[model samples]
Target: MTILGSHFVDFDTARILVADDDPILREFAAVHLATPTLEVEVAEDGVFALERLQQGGIDIALIDLDMPRMDGFELIERIRWDDQLKHLPIVVVTGREDMVAVDKAFAMGATSFVVKPLNWRLLSHQLAYVLRNAQAESSVRSRLHDLQRVSDLKDRVLRLSRQKLTGPLNDILDSAQTIEHLSTIPEISASLRRIAEASVALTRVHADMGEAERLTPAP
Candidate 1:
């Protein structure tokens, strides 16, 4: 339930998928991961696994590196490109111990890696850790997105307010300029010219404010 000393997965309420080309291995894993704790589904290959995933309701996935129709690497790529499933936790279970393959799996967004002929006890603990971390990460990302959206909305409001203020200032400056040019009184014209200058300054201030608002980051 608790992972890395933080957060809980509530595994009893979770659903997991096990995909392998070997029926015996698949069945073994299904039995191993299944307890009163977690629900498990088995797929014979990557193709079937991907199909079942798209049908929805999968929280975590265990994939075998070798399979017919489609391989684990290709399956990871497809899952990464899917908007709804991109964040799903993928754990690669393979006998291959090559450093290159391990790095490649991480690069492809695998949440974890495990060698085949699995030690069921360690795997159960690892799976619990992965699920807890995944849930915590998702919660953080959702909060960040909400914060960004609110920030963007605030920026737009400031920009629109500045824009509304800028137009009136511009009109006032133009009217003051016209009145100043037509009048013969030097003192009145000087005051009008000062008023026009203040209007221009206000316009510049709002123009800068609008630009700053536009530069705010989006969600």
Candidate 2:
């Protein structure tokens, strides 16, 4: 693909939305990009496109810069602004190869762009690549979010352990140690030593929990 792309898209099932003011272009895209595993949906304008997108199930979108009701740039912005639609892969298909328009589309969160007079033979490959890229990005984002959540939970647990357990445990260990030293009776000293030992073990466990985050993760 001439523009940005990613992993091969799934051939088992994929849905593409083409939003353009030109019915001919829309029809052309639908005809060429479709496969047994991939289906294409068309919208004559950005407004209609956005509506279909809002209903969900689209895996990628090919958008035209010029459209009534809502332009491609605005549509891109709107899609990115909507949390549910933000990650949807968007490829801008423009009539001109103007760099400014291309940059603007990207700034508005388009996944990629294609200049006019597209090569029909390569269009499907381009769409597949774009979709794969989007999915990979989404996967990375989800993993990072999950890791953050685990980090936050670990912090909360450590804070609780320090506040509610560690201080009291230290006190118990100190008291046991003092009692063990003060007592002359062997049995009493032995029992006090065990209490101190148990307290020490628990405190060590808490410390280990605090350090667990730095430990190497399982593959």
* Model 2, residue 123: C-alpha shift (Å): 1.3
lDDT of 1: 0.85
Model 2 sits at a Cα RMSD from the real structure of 5.5
- Candidate 2, poorest ten consecutive residues by summed lDDT: 1-10
The regions of model 1 sitting more than 4 angstroms off are 2-12, 96-99, 172-208, 214-219
Best by TM-score: 2
**Model 1, residue 187: what's the lDDT?**
99
lDDT of 1 by residue, 34-71 (tens): 76668999999889999999999999999887889998
Tens-digit lDDT string for candidate 2 (1-219): 233463333454789999988878888877777776789899999899999999999999999898999999999999999989999999998866488999999988998888888886567778878787787898999999999898787777766776698789999999999999999999999999999999999998878876774463532
Clashes of 1: 0
* lDDT of residue 193 for candidate 2: 99
Q: Name the lDDT value of residue 65 in candidate 2.
A: 90
